[model samples]
Target chain A: MSHASGPPPEDRIREDHRRAVEGAPDGGRDTTPAVGRRGGPALWRRAVEGSPVALARQAFKDARWSYLYKDDTSYRVRNGADANERIQAAARRMRGSTEIPEGVDANGPFINAPVWTWEVPAYFFLGGVATGSSFVALAADLAGDERSAAIARKVTIAAIGPGAPLLVLDLGRPARFLNMMRIFKPRSAMNAGAWCLMAFSTAGGAAVAADVLGRRRVAKVLGAQTALLGTYLGSYTGVLLASTAVPIWARSRLFLPPIFVCTAVATGAATNRLVLAATGMPSGHPTRDALGTIETVAMGAELALSSFNEKRLGQLADVLEHGRAGRLFEFARWAVRAGLMLRFTRGRFAWEHHVASGLYLAGGLAFRFAWIEAGKASAGDDEAVARMARGKATVKDRLRDGRTTARVRTSARHPGRDARAARVYADAVRRLSLAIEGVLRRG
Target chain B: MTEIAIDRPESRRMGFFTDTTVCIGCKACEVACKQWNDLPADGAVFRKTSSYDHTGSLSASTWRHVRFVEQTEPVPLPDLPAYGGGNGGHGEVDLVAAAEAHGVPQMDRWLFMSDVCKHCTNAGCLDACPTGALIRTEFETVIVQPDVCNGCGYCVPSCPFGVINRDPYDGRAAKCTLCYDRLEDGLEPACAKSCPTDSILFGPYDELVETAKGRVLALHERGVTDAYLYGAGDEPGEQLAGELGAFFLLTAPPERFGLPAQAESPAQENGPVATAAGLAAAALGLAAAVGAFARAHRR
Candidate 1:
C-alpha cells in the first residue's frame, strides 16, 4: 500500500483548486512526504457517511425475515411464506375472537396522536371563517356597500357566535378558557392566539350588535377593530401547528401561516357570497362580483403557496399526501379548483356559484382537518421523520446511501509541519488565553 | 401574564445524557421515577406491543419510559464487542446457524432506549403555557406547575416530543419535572440515581456531552461504526445538547425512539407567522384604504 499522497500537482488543479495547490502560482510548496499528503473531498465525503436515514433504510432492505402476516414486527420466514404468518400463528394460539393477538404489537409503538380532537379542528375552522368574514365586513362597510356589509357582518357574527363555546369545549372545562387569559406572553403563538380569539369575538360580536341596534357609526368602528384582531386570528392556527415537532408542521414553518391566512380570506369571501345569495343579492351587482373575484384570487394564492411549501418540505410532504390526510387534501384541492372555475363560467346569480361558494367554505374546513390528520400520520411514521431531519437526498446519494448529513469534516494528516511553525501557533493560543484571563480579572 | 423568556440560561444547565448503548432494558429507572414522584400506576400488565416494552410512552401519569425497538437486520459476520464492553469483556455469539434453523431469514438487532423529557432549551410547553404553568427552572430544566396549569390543552399539541400531556381525570397538563425538587436537595433525579447500568448519567449538560461523545468514539473503535450520539451537536429544532437541556447518546436514529426529527418549539413559530400576518394585514389595509378613497372621491 503505497500511501504517498500530497496536495495535487499544478496541472491537476482547477482554478479554484489551483489557489490551494502547493506548486500553483498563488500557493507555496508544502514539501510534505507522499504518505502524509493532504488532498481533496474524498476524505470529507467519507466523514459524512451513514446518516440515520441511510442506516435505517439499509436495515429495512436487509430484512429477510418478516412475520407471515401483517403486524409490527419481522419474524424469520422462509422465502415463500405468507407475510401474515406471525399474526395467524398468534391468532391460532389465542382463546377466541375476544382475545387480542400478541402479534398486533408488531405494528410498533402506539404513537400518542395529537390530543387536539374534533373540537380543536372545528374551532380552527370557525375561527378562520370568522376572521375571514370580519375582513370582508370591514372592507364592504368602508366602501359604503351597505347591503354587502350587512350580509358580511351577519356571517361574521354567526360564525363567532358558537366559536367561543367550541374553544371552551375543546379546553374541556369553562375554567380552562378563563385560564388562557391568566397571562400574556406575546412571543408565544398560543398566548397570542388566545388573546386574538377573545378580541375578535368581542369586537365582531359588538359590531353586529351595534348594527342590530341601528348604530351604523359604532358598528363600522367595531368592525374595523374586529378585522384588526382577525388578522392574527386567521393566521395563528397555522403557526400553532408549525411550532410543534410534528414533521409536516415544522418543515414548512415560513409558508404554512401564509397559506392559512390566504385560505382564511377565501373562506371569508365564499361565506359572504353564500350569505348574499341566500339574501337575494343580485348577481349583476358589483359587490357580488367583487366578492367572487376575491374568493377566486384568495384560493389561487392559497394553492400556490402551499404547493411551494410542500415542495420545500421534501420527505415530510408525504405527511400531507398519504392516507386520510391524502384523501381529504385531494378533495380540498379539487373543491378550490372547482370554485375558481365556476367564477369564470358563470356569474354569482347562477346555481353553480352557490354550490361553488359552499365548496369553498367546505374546502377551507377540510384543509384544516386534513392538516391535523397529516400531522398525526407524520408522527406515526418514524422513517419519514428520520429522512426529513437528514433532509432531501442529493442526486448521487439519493440512489445509494442517502446518508449525507450537514458537516463532512475530515482530519487531513499534514506531514510534519516544520515544528517551529506549530510551536509558534501553540504559544500564541496559550498567550491569548492568558491575556483574556488577565483582562477578565482587571475588569 | 405568563412571562416567557425563550433564551437558554447562562448558568450551567444540569441534565441527563442517556447512553442507550449501555442500557440493559431494565425498568429500575421507571420504578424509581414513580416511587420518588408518588405518581399513580400506569399498570404492570403485559400490553401487546411491537417489542417487550409494556409502558407504551411518556404521559402525565408515567414520566419515564423505556422503548424496545427491534431492527430486522443481520449482525456483522465478525461480531464486535457489544456496547459497554471491549474492556476484558467478551460477548461474542455465533448465531448464524441458530438464525437459519429457526426458519428466520436474517439476524435481529434489538435496541432498547430509555425515553424521557428532553427539557429542551426552546421548550414548546414552556413557551405555549398561558397560565405561567410550564416554566424553566434555574437548572435549565422545564417543570410544569401543576396548580397553575389550567388544562387548556394548548401545551398538549404544542410539545414537539409529546412529552407533556393533560390527564383525562386530572384535567391539567403534566410531565417530567427532571426531579427539580430532588435537585434542590442536592440529589440527582430518581431515574438517574436508580439506573443500574449507568445508561442514564446526570451531570453538567456540557460535561455529559463530552462523556457521551467519548463513549460513541469508543464504540466506533470497537467496530460498532453505527454507534452515534443524538442530540449532542447543533442539529437544530428540538434536538438535545444543541437545544435541549437533556440530550442522549443514541445507537440509532432519534425517531426510532419516538423523538421528533425536526422539533420547533412554540416560541420559534411566532416570528414567521407574525411576519406573514403583518404583510397580509398591510396589503388588506391598503386595499380597504383605496376603497375608502374611491368612495370619498365618488361624490
Candidate 2:
C-alpha cells in the first residue's frame, strides 16, 4: 500500500510475522505459505510457516475489501496488483461504465447530508427556564404565601414564554407546531411534552390571572393544576435524553430525569428567595424559610446524584468530571455550598443574604447548560464505542469458556465406550484450552 | 347507569426499535423527520467540529440526530499468501512497515448512531409540565400541545435526552412525535420509513424488542461481541414503569450512547430531598429569628 516507500524494511516485517506465529499448532514445521502456488487453500499441507502478523494483516485487509465490494461479487475475480488497486477496480465497477462523467469529482458526489439542525445552547436555556420556574412555583405553593405564590406564578409564566418560542423556532417549519396536538400518540415523547407544556402553562397563567383579578377561588383551582403540571415539566427532560442512542446520555438516562427535577427545584427556590427578599418579605416569614429549605435540600440531592452518576459510569465519567463539564460541576458545587450556608446563617446576614440565592439560580442554570454540553460532547466521541465493544468481547469470551468447560465435564462423566468418543472429548477440551490461552495471551 | 373500567386498550402502548449496527450515519431520518412534520428547516449556520454530525444534538427543530464517532487501534491486515509472494501477502506487502514508512495514522474504527427522543414509559417531561401542554398519545408516544403550551419551558428540563426544546423564534416546546399523523394513517414514521439501511426499523413494540435481542445474540455469535440493547426489559421505578418507546442496539456501553444503563427518575428521587433540605433551612432560620426576638425583648 505504500507509495514508493522503498519496500518497507523487510527485516521488521519478517520479525513481526515471526512473533505473531510463534505458538502455532504446527510449530515451525513446514516453512511455506499457507496458500499453495495455484491460489488455493493448503490448510493440511502447511504447518503454519507464514508469519501470523502478516496473516492477521492479510485477513483484515481481505475482510475490508470483501465488505466494500460484496455487492459486486465479480470484483474479486479480476484481481489487482495491490489492495488499493483492487479497491479502485471495485469502485470503478460499482460506478458503472462512464465516459467523461460530467460534474463528477474524485471525492465522489455529496449523496446525502444532514438536513436537521439542533441548537445545543437553546436546549440548555429552555431546560434551565423550565426547572427554575418549577422550583419557584413549588416553594410558593408549599408556603401558602400569596405574594410569593404570585411571584412564582409570574416567573413560571415568563420562563415558559421564552422557552416555548425557542422550541418552536428550532423546528424547521414552525407553523406545524400545532400539529402536535392533532392526535395523541402516547409512545411519542414530543406528543407528551406538548400536552405537559399546555397543561402547565394554562394552569400557571390561570392562577396568575386569578390572583391579578382578585378571584381567590379561581386561583386555588389553577394553583393545583400548576403544581401538577410543574412536576411533569420539571422531570421529563431526563426521559427525553435517556431515550436517545447517545451512549453517555443513554447510560445515565435514569439518573438524569430526577437530577434535572432536583436542579430545577433548587433553582426555583433560589428565584423565589430572591423575589421575596427584593419585595422585602419579613425575615421570619414561612415562605422565606420554606424557600431556603428547598434550596439547601435540592442542592444536596443534585450534587449527590451527579456524583453517583459519575461513579457508576467509569470511563463515561470523563463527560461530567473532566473537561468543561467539570468546571460547571465545580461551580454548581460552590453555589450549593454557598446557598446552604446562607440558608442556615442567622441574624443580620439572614435578611441580607439574597446573594446566595442568586448564586444558586445562576449555578443551577450553569449546571443545566453543562449537562447538555457534556452529553453533546460524549455523543461526539469514539472512545466510548470502542470501550463498549471491548466489554462485550470480554462477556462473550467468559460465556464461551464456561460453556466449553461444562461440555468437557459432562463428556468426562458420560464415559462413552468407544475410544473415538474419548478422542472427540479430548479434542474439544484441547480446542477450548487453546481458546482460553489465546484470550489470556492477548490480554 | 354507567360501567367503570380500568386498563384501557389505549394504555397498552407502542414503541420504536433503533438498530445502530447497520446505521450508515446518513441523516436521512433527520431530514425526513423535519419534512414530514412540516417543521422549519433548522437553519444551517451551526457546525459541530468534532464529527461529521453537524446537527449537534436533538432539539425542537431537529427531532432526530445522527452521531458519528471514530476510534483508532493498531491492527494488521491479513497477508494474502494466495497471491504470488513469499510468507507475507502476495509480493510481501508488509502493511505495518509500509504504514510506518508512509507516516499513515494508526488504524482507527468509526461508529455512527442516529439519536432521537426516547418516549419513556414514565416520561419526566410529561410529569413536570404544569400547563398540561405535554401529553401521552393513545399510541403511547409523548407529544407537546403547541396551542396550549404557553411557552412554559418546564418540559425542557424534564427531558433526559435533552431532545425537546423551545423554538427560539416561535416560543413553543417541540421535539419528535414519531410522526403521529403517519401512524394514525397506518404508515410508519418518516424517519423509520426513510432509513435506507433498515437501521431504524419500525414495528410493534414487542416484536422490535425481540428482534433487537436476536440481533444482539447474532452479533455475539459472530466475532463482533460488543452488542447490547438499551432501555428494554427493566422497569426501575413508578416514575419509569414500562420500557422505552424508542430503544437502541448499541455496540458500546449505554453511556457511550448518552443513555443511563440503570435509569432513575430525577424528579421523584430528588423531590423529597429538596423538600427536606428546605424544611431544615426554614426551621433553623425560624429558630434563630425567634431567639433574636426574645433577646431583644429581654434587653
Question: Candidate 1, overall lDDT?
Answer: 0.63
Q: Give the TM-score of candidate 2.
A: 0.45
Runs of candidate 1 exceeding 4 Å displacement: A1-112, A172-174, A212-214, A306-315, A347-350, A393-443, B1-12, B44-50, B71-109, B206-228, B233-241, B253-256, B259-266, B269-299
Provide C-alpha RMSD values for all models, in order.
23.3, 24.1
Q: Compute the lDDT of residue B47 as modeled in candidate 1.
A: 62
Tens-place lDDT per residue, model 1, A307-333, is 877776665677678799999999999
Q: For each candidate, what is the lDDT?
A: 0.63, 0.54
TM-score of chain A of each: 0.62, 0.59
TM-score of each prediction: 0.68, 0.45
What level of docking quality does candidate 2 show? incorrect
- B1-299: candidate 1 lDDT, tens digit per residue: 12222332443468887878767888898989877776655455576545567777888768888887777666553343222233324454435444456755556767788888888766667766766667766677788865456567667656767687776655566788888766654567889878876777877776565555555554555555556555554433223313667776665445556654344454444445444654574356336433632454254
Clashes of 1: 21
* Candidate achieving the largest DockQ: 1
